[model samples]
Target: MTSVKDFRVEEEPTATDLGRGRFVFSDRYSVFDWGEMPDHIPNKGASLCLMGAYNFELLDVNHVPTHYVGVVEDGEVKDLGECESPPTEMAIELTQVPDLPHEDGEYDYGAYHEVAGENYLIPLEIVFRNTVPVGSSLRKRGEPADYGLDTEEWPEEAVDLPEPVVEFSTKYEEQDRYLDRDEADDIAGVVDLDQLEELALAVNHILTDHAARAGFAHEDGKIECLYHDGTVKVADVVGTFDENRFSYDGQQVSKEVVRQYYKRVQPEWVDAVAAAKQEAIETGEPNWREQCEIEPKHLPDEIVDALSDLYCAGTNAYVDYDWFDAPSIEDAVAAARDLN
Candidate 1:
């Protein structure tokens, strides 16, 4: 099981073949790579599943290759429209995810690729940004000029990019870190890094336009892909609030809301997590959590309810479907702001 979802492999993929599986998304949420949180946001699982299915279908219409098969409802895989109610399970084509060999305080991707062969989940995440929002890592990684902003420093608010910026980060590392193009290309093995970037940009364009139509700003998102038969197909979920950052009327309408809430309410735990990560880097320790003494506190019930409404409302707005009887996105965001 992943941090927020339980996965079942009906057929396991071989080194050169595809398999079958389903992801049962739970109401569980995670922040700061802390595995699972103490509370579950009501309806969050169904919201993400429906939103992911919607985006996958939209991508299919745009001729984007993906591992999505359909949503699972009543023990059967069905198209999003065919599902009578909101779904929590998603059927997907499986790709081999061989354990990345780690030794001497370094990950051996060459060994991983040799075992992964042609059919595998790419060990890199492709991120695309349409806007450099406050607290964005891009601000620390690049200069304003690097992103085409004609300013000496980054603005206090979000800045729209002249063009979508694509980036790569390690997926299987103890602590995911950004990688340069050359390193990313080397890690990608036989998969073309340029093609991956192109695919990520296409996804960003599609999601950005979709969010605009729905009156939301899609700031950024990342996607993982599976390489099979010399083809790259987007794997896992896409365009969901959990996977992307969205804002409505200058307010966060995505999981960032919850993360920010934690930052405000549990600052010590957040700081400890960061410090532990740095300590791990210096100490060559793989498990950073072991070094952190602080543990996260549970979110207030009111905050959880507001976030639940936000997820459902955002999904309803993005997909143009009323899957949940929740408040409007505006109302949801307002409620979240009040709680925070």
Candidate 2:
């Protein structure tokens, strides 16, 4: 079924006793809290599928357990082969998603965690940041000085952190909110906070090392974990463009490109969306659009084409294969930067 991201989960026939499903990635893209936007970035799905499977394999090599099984190739589940223009479906072990009910727009996460017990999602998105980029929530939420930087304020450009910073944010909520360690620990229930943090760091290191080898700066990323059998394993897709922020030559090369495009081209709409979200928080109502009376406009065709090229070229570069006949990653990133 459809979820926040532009993907559908289908039950695989081989999943008889095994709780397995296929994540059929789509070309559709989403930014901010908006669901599928009007524009579709071509080859985006293939890029994510390939990159995700690549990272999953890397994690496996590092002896990290994950829900990833393999990619569906030639109508069968098999190892992810050479990079393809458009990757095939991906298989993952399924886990229980317990109901997290809300009362009057306020989530009862404690009760939800109680019901979740073990063998479920940890209910927190562990975010690991290596750099604070422009428009990063960290810039707005805290000061650079607070992060041990000499500057009292953050610069307009991205600034690398003195050390990697790991934070927790609520997942599966209407509006995901960043949480302090104690709050996160309580919500995560049986999962040990320190162990979870270690896993996030390890996963970040894995992705960061690979990104460096691929000539991209792995600025930040988030991962979800599955707590099963008294152990926590990396769950869900990891290290894709959508899940992580990557930069090339000081320019964002990930989905941040789309977010920046919207901020520049549709400032009014973006501001309206932010205002709506704030109003929702203040009023405790879920329908922010009704309160704000604003709708996000679709990206122009040229922007969509640029994004498609970026995804394809970036994928090719990261996978080190001629997956698509597109411009080089540098050229695509330059084009995107020109838009900004």
Residue runs of model 2 more than 4 Å from their true location after superposition:
3-18, 82-85, 290-292
Against the reference, the lDDT scores of all candidates come to 0.92, 0.82
Prediction 2 TM-score vs. true: 0.92
**Residue-by-residue lDDT tens digits, candidate 2, 241-262:** 8899887887778888888878
Clashes of 2: 0
lDDT of 1 by residue, 265-323 (tens): 88999999999999999888999999999889988888888999999999999999899
Quote each prediction's TM-score. Answer: 0.98, 0.92
Best by lDDT: 1
Candidate 1: stretches off by over 4 Å: none
List pairs with backbone clashes in candidate 2. none
